[model samples]
Target chain A: MAAVQSDDPGLTPRSTMSWWFRREARIAPYLYISPFFLLFLVFGVFTVAFTAWVSLHDWHIFDTAAGGGTFVGLDNYARLLNDARFWRSATNTFSILLMSTIPQMLLALVLAELLNDRRLRGPHIFRSGLLIPNITSVVAITIVFQSLFGRHYGLINVALDFIGLDMVNWTSSRIGSHFAIATMVNWQWTGYNTLIFLAAMQSIPSDLIEAARVDGAGRIKRWWKITVPLLRPTILFATVLSVIGNFQLFAQPLLFAPGVGSMGGNDQQFLTILLYLYNMAFRQFQFGYASAIAWMLVLLTAVAALMVYAGVGYLNRRENRSALEVERMRERANARQEAGA
Target chain B: MTNVDAVKAQSAAGPTPGNERQAPTFKPNKRRFSWANNWHYLVLTVALFISVFPFYWMFVVGSNTNADVAQVPPRITPGPNFIENATNAMNAVPFLRSLLNTFIVAGTVTVSAVFFGTLAGFAFAKMQFRGNKALMAFVIATMMIPLQQLGLIPLYMLMDRFGWVGQLRAVIVPALVTGFAVFWMRQVIATSVHDELLEAGRVDGCATFGLFRHVVIPSVRSGAAVLGMFTFLFMWNDFLWPLVVLGGNQDAHTIQIALRNMSQTYYADYALVLAGTFMSLIPLIIVFVIFARQMIAGVMEGAVKG
Candidate 1:
């Protein structure tokens, strides 16, 4: 890979010395890029693979035997399938996921459309304000939300009392506790998703909207017909991200039901998969079972992502086919007119 | 503001040459006093209020005493017991130690991420090395795999094996480089650093690393600054991994852990809990305010191109 030496009178003697420099230059990029690979391999790839291997054994955190725990292939997986708490955690995770994701996406879409209006002044203020919740630590959010959802003197309870409604114990009932946690999730993430949607909306061609308006389409109709379809890719992307995030929900519920010690509440009402995995590994010292739970979550996240990806792809294909047909029909009309003329 | 300017410039330039005649006929209806015109602003105002109100309420509660906080209407204004409550918050746990520990961890992570992310990003963007494309794809693919979910147990085991289970390095070292940061820096370097500048540097007898130090780093300073800010904020606010790794180790607790500890200890003391919560959030808010534009742009850019 060395370049040919030039015929300059002063360069002839130094050419041999410059060979090392040239070689170094050729390999410098790899040196520069090695840190990340090394770190990722140690912390990321190795850990993931090791966790998989650990899941196949009957390992415990404090199993202080001379050798590693005995091999018990698929026992942890079989146990996970039959565990009622596992099923309960899975249900809680999906329930919270649906509750949080659906409203968050819809509200974010509406908020993004509103903020996309060019006539709005100081839109950045609102946009930045929305991110405040996102930037705050989850521990702080959970603490503040716990006080807000407090049964006795919470501001929410006081507001309910003002409306002649009984104070609901937000931490006791399963649905109530789930709703409380989901509210925090929604509060923290809706603004973030709104900004994402707003970015996607901003990238849409304005001429398309103007054309729809010229055709007498109202504002909402223009959004529904033109903007939404163009934003399908971004929406799908955001949905997949939300699914991955929500399924792995942890700190909010953990802190929300602090006294319960990972049961989430008295009846284990809002025990998310991640929290359950955490309790299993750290609390119960069942490292192998927790690894199994982690793998199951990974599988669930993959399946959710795949389903959304497939659904979006199918819709996009159908839309493209119809659009192609419309173009063909327009071409035929143009050809007919040209022939007649 | 730049986005606004771009939109204005595009509109001022009107449609493409062929479509110029039809552009004026479909000039999007001008501002009118209708629900459509005002409703969006109203909605945005409400959203802004919802977004900011919790922090405001936290501040109010933090400043009040238990008695003042329990009042029916709740103390809407800052009460005079701020110092008392803050002292209680500090006394509840090693709050100051946690803050210092968090800063050390976050600062180290940010510095390392910026340095290494910039280095690797420049290499991937500008250099033609073996397996560059595949390596870059691998980095991007790593972003999709959430580290906490899959790697927690093994990572903990590894840390235990290395005798690092309760140390700040357990959190800081693992976060020293991130896939997102590398991807971000790569995008910025590719767009911002022109090839001619590097060629000029090379012609002037600058070495490869020298060219990177002088040409690439200076060119991508703003991008690096944004990355640094994000890294710091993420490290500061990170919960799960640190929570797992640092578990119950009071000496190694970060600000988040300290805050959780305070809340659990002072579960009955709303004022104390709120004070600790507010204290932990102060740095983030200040950072957010100072770098709001850059942070917003960073998030939007990542979403659009990711």
Candidate 2:
């Protein structure tokens, strides 16, 4: 075979070519994967650049910016920084993130714990069921959730009334509407997070837990001192995802908000940064301003992600130091015992 | 990694009962259920119910008539009007035409993605290539850049300029080169395909492409099938781009768009909307039901290995 000849090094002179052949062999995988990078270069990098370029000008979707505006340098960014609407959208994004992601992660951890239980029957069924919401069409989910959250005649209100509570205008008021959106998000995503956590949990060694139990630690004590601390990486990953996804919260709010064609709810209650940008560029035709806003959002999310990464890294380093200190004390004890002997 | 492992081991040790103190106590070694273990079944049951209830409601609503669905207390019963509702859905929307369009778009995209994806994947995995490490890293990292974050306007513009807007090619062509599919295929091919097999084919006078055709393709068929299914589902269920590109173009509207339009206009027609929604879901459910094992295997395999 060609592989055998190449190994033996007793083949023809042409086969023995060294510099060029070796270099080509080294680079072949790169050649194979080039299409993705090529597309990314053209479509991905260029798109962001074009958006930034457009943002610098008074770009409009329909009419030319020359009709009413000029290329005001840093004006859009300055205006956005001072804009109440931008701040309100940012607030809405964070509020929804808090309302949804915190509980979602907690619930996921609980579910993952449950799944890891040996007594649980048909765990696969439950796991697959969790993924159902993830697989369903977003459009379909939004529409279904809209009806379910409707104030007057929705099933949610009906259930509320049965429990002797007044009907809540879920999609009208800012706080109420946010709760509705958050619930939808939580319902759809909790299972997904649970599965990810479960995967993380399953990778935990049995011997560690056995040792902890042998040390006379109760289940709750072990979980707090063991599982929670250990699942940090998975938690960090999920949290970052939640943050990014919350920023781009569009379709649900766009659909759930009661008004006919509004991007956000009444008073711009649920308008996330991405939704605001979408409305500005596509709806209001403020393409330039929208581009600036979009770029700002990208920068904000990146910074937030980095902050989380650094914070987690610092905490982990501290934990590692304490662990190493314990090991040092144990080594000192062993040395003293040897000296005494 | 060591800390993570240590913590995992601690949790896996489970809980020792108070009976652990007395070795002569009745079954002293019996494990005590941790609060987590005690609550596990309860939590799982609650999660399962919540998860499955919506789909259960969808199916329940599908069987009911429009009037029944709108009634004061929503009927939990299955009505005899599912057939009538389905007929109405077909008449109101160009259901058959849209289905055909979906099939063509998803089919072409899936087939092309699998074929090209496997070729590229195989080349990356098996062949000696230049710049393989950097190129593969680039391919893998592309998943982090949100697609909608980039290329929304220009992608639309590109399609518009090419006169591919509202054409099935608009969906198919872009989808045919997914980074994920290529990565997946590369992995599957690397594990399944043998260098020995390819060398044997070369020794028997097979050309590079011929070796791929005769040997590699057959070996990676299951991987291709799984990837093809995912490609199909993604295209079929896509809404935003389809909505933008096919705006108000009835002839080119996808099922998702049609369903959205129907729900928005016929807001009170819960039964009809639910029926339409269920109809859209049937293909996915059927596909999953048939290939559940393979799909689950693929996902679990990725999780363990990755």
Instruction: Indicate which candidate wins on TM-score.
Output: 1
Go through the candidates in order and give each one's DockQ.
0.47, 0.31
lDDT of 2 by residue, B71-138 (tens): 67877677777777777777777777777877887788788778778877977788875566666787
Taking the tens digit of each residue's C-alpha lDDT, what string does model 2 give over A296-317?
8888778777877898899888
Query: What's model 1's overall lDDT?
Result: 0.84
Indicate the residue-level lDDT of A211 in model 2.
52
What ranges in model 1 sit over 4 Å off? A1-14, A318-341, B1-36
User: How big is the positional error of residue A265 in model 1, measured in Å on the Cα after superposition?
Assistant: 0.9
Docking class of 2: acceptable
